[model samples]
Target: MNQAGMISTSVSTTTMISGSHLFNISGHSITKELPAGKCIMSSPFVVGGYQWAIMYYPNGLNSYDQPGIAFTLELQSEGSGVEARLEFCLVDSHGRPSDIHKASSFCEFGYVSCNRGFSGFITHEELEESWYLRNDSFVVKCTVGILDSSVVEASGCGTPGNANDTHQAEHLPPSDLHEQLRKLLESGEGADVEFNVDGQIFSAHRCILAARSPVFHAQFFGPIGEKNFHNIEVEDMEAVVFKVLLQYLYTDVLPDLNEFGSIQIKETSASAIMAQHLLAAADRYSIERLKMICEEKLLGTISIDTVATTLALAEQHGCGRLNEACIEFLSRGGNLKEVMDTDGFGHLMLSCPSMFNLILANINDPNVLRDLVIRFSKTSIKS
Candidate 1:
């Protein structure tokens, strides 16, 4: 067994292999300030084929335990008799990992017992004086090495079956093909076609563009579609949005939205307006995965200010998941009336009038429903 900086174990006679589980303690610096608890815990995180959690006691576990904080590493993984070697650390804020507390000896643990590292690992006085606690967050890094019996059975660490894929993914860097195609797209090398969105021109390789998008495939090659020997003028899209759409087509990624100067969505607004436009672009192009990604981003951005317009956008693009997310968010009783007061609310009400029933049913006051009904009736009569 190796201890000082490495942990290892062989549960069976065949071979020995190891994997690491990093249990990061984020948002835990304030746990020390909270009063009167012997055991406070970090949220459970899954890694290395196990579920693990961090337990910290503000008060010492007992009279002999240190007055500061203590830590416990728990293995919540299923199945028994599995062997694991563990190391624990209190990561330093000073950027020097050597300045922090780490266990010198690797300890073995399972569901039967937890390895409580050195008690009074750092006294309350010692830590309070240290920079380890910053911005009410500190990290406790735990590395667990699990013994794999399959290694011995295979004669060596040679990956068997689908693990070959996993091993390849782990060892291989990003494929050169991805970078080459990205460079080709950026350099406009061998670009066979162009799309002019309003006045801006986007040059693309026909084969690559067609390979990535069915819409592009159809427009460039399929029956009943036009052949673009020259620049095809694109309509109903901003040039900036089209560039990103084409970028996704080339690279299967959305460049960090922060890098784009044209995106108007701010941090507070949940950044949906650009996603909405992207969603429409994706829908227009009939790109399912891109549409789903845009829908997911839009779903996260839904709130009182954006839900109405988002719902309408979802409806326009036929994003059922996003459409449902918007209606469901508004249906929650927390603040429907206030949301209805926004300008987008009338647009959604007029567009998705049937949803008003669900909104009326879920809101606290029924009078709102009556008033809207009366308003709609009067508008109908006048029309």
Candidate 2:
């Protein structure tokens, strides 16, 4: 109804819906045990007809430069696009939002950019002293507002008004293939092969092992494949190590170091001992991913008592980065003298005599060189 004697129609107006979710994270100290980039996801919540979740990283996102914890908003449902306003705030002891540590942002959630987060939402030091943290537990409130809008048009004449089209996207759950495989491994269902390791028997499927390891494939299915496929005896690898290797082959997860103990052959952390043996077993089986995991574990647990032996293991296994890192750590002030006095150092000397040259090349301190020469000469004379 207008001055032009024609009717104009408006299709729709903008709408917004908002909701909040609170995450209760207990055992905060235990959560910190997880490595950087590892995260705990909150349960999914629905707001404005879409599902969303929160991702909390106790040790930040990047493996290096972890200044604080990280928090991210994740869109769990697939959709065309969503415009959202997100706010994350810690709940204080009295159940109110903490004023000092609040973060807010307006972001678009789509297939291409489905995740938005803060790297350092709050520093570790600040959080430790803040009242928001209590009893090794904390709560975070996440608020989300979903915005939807349709084109508003001023149309003249009898031209039909255009309507916005919306499609229903299917909701897909996260994959649990690894979990199913782990169940298969645990249940020993349909297992066609058996392995005897150090008097302990393990049952597994030949196809799965063949699929996971090239060595197993050649041993089980190749032209020179084993004539008796039902029973295979593995040598040199411990039963526990073989058990962990099979778990990784099926589940692709690292072993829990707490479940294992030190090898007792040296004065080193339990994790370092387990990782050392796993590294050797990984090399023998040609599992590159497991090898890399063992390497990272060893690198993180390096100490004066373990570095020399670790360096020798790295050299024998051709872990170049680990080899260089060990050399670099040993070259630092006073580390050489301390490491040389340990039993691991004697083993390192005997196993890798040429590594002395590598260590000397990295050392620039004259006093360190003199002490190293004296130590080496004495060890040599003693041997």
Candidate 3:
């Protein structure tokens, strides 16, 4: 035997061909076409320098290890072409032979060249070329591309979902105090009345005269109620007092310091004196313009007696500004002594003795103490 050229009996023992092929060559008759269409190709075919594995139907009823084989045989051809395609058929351990379907008749062969050691197949399309196939498995290969680059650029600028919808208003300059007050006083009359005072307009509704003083009512209602006062009447003394009261009411602007000529200094009297109660009432009702007017008037006409009354009212109603002003006025030297010596000083003093002490502690003049002692002695004699 030519040992090198001979087919060894040992090799034939391991690689045996049986079943239908053997029967057909032996001239034996067999029924059926060997169930050809039901047969599938089995794995491991070599072409070029690469080994091709069998492809499986995605919906085939088989496990990953038990593939229903069908694969393309790819090869580099010598002078035949750049590439060639081949097809195959297989048989299982049973006598079932694979149906010999069409071969490479419908397939298109193509060549791919890649850098040595790079180890991957490249396709014409960029997206497809970025995939690696090895041993029948496909994996994504990381590569820079337009999609990732664009996303990185956008992220560098900002996050995807942040836009503000709210906008703030611009600041305005301060207004003229007296001009604003004048305008407020001039605005009209009635239950539902609108008036402009100190740069703001005030609106009041369902209001009535709680006291019969035309001047007092005028200040309370502004020009609107002032106009209505033409139809109202009062006796001489009441009308005079009401006129002074009305002046205090209209502007929260008080009369000159000289106007308190002969009036008594009591809670109602002091409130009536400067009309601060009216301003306070306006503040209580949320009439901003009126409250400003009242505040302005209180600042202009602040006095020892009025401060005493206002301090008490301010403390009761939590009016911090008014309370501060009262403290400031009493802190001045002459005012506290004057308040303690006035006709109803004892009554006023009794209502706010702490305020008196606060005044005494703050007064800078030594004479203020002497005056307070003399005034208390006179009050005791009268009582």
TM-score for candidate 2, please give it. Answer: 0.56
Q: After superposition, how far is residue 20 of candidate 2 from its true place, in Å?
A: 40
> For model 1, how does the per-residue alpha-carbon lDDT over 210-295 read when each residue is reduced to its tens digit?
78788888988989777654779999888888988888888887876545557544434524677777888888888889888888
- Which residues of candidate 1, in runs, are more than 4 Å off? 1-173, 261-270, 374-383
lDDT of 3 by residue, 105-223 (tens): 22333443211111111211211111111122332111111111111112222122322111111234455664554444444434344433333334433233233333344555665
lDDT of 3 at 350: 56
Better of 1 and 3 by lDDT: 1
Report every candidate's CA lDDT. Answer: 0.65, 0.81, 0.39
Q: What TM-score goes with each of the models?
A: 0.56, 0.56, 0.28
lDDT of 2 by residue, 244-339 (tens): 889999999876965877344545477788888889998998999999989988877878988988999999999976886677568666788899
Candidate no. 3 TM-score: 0.28
Ordered list by lDDT, greatest first: 2, 1, 3
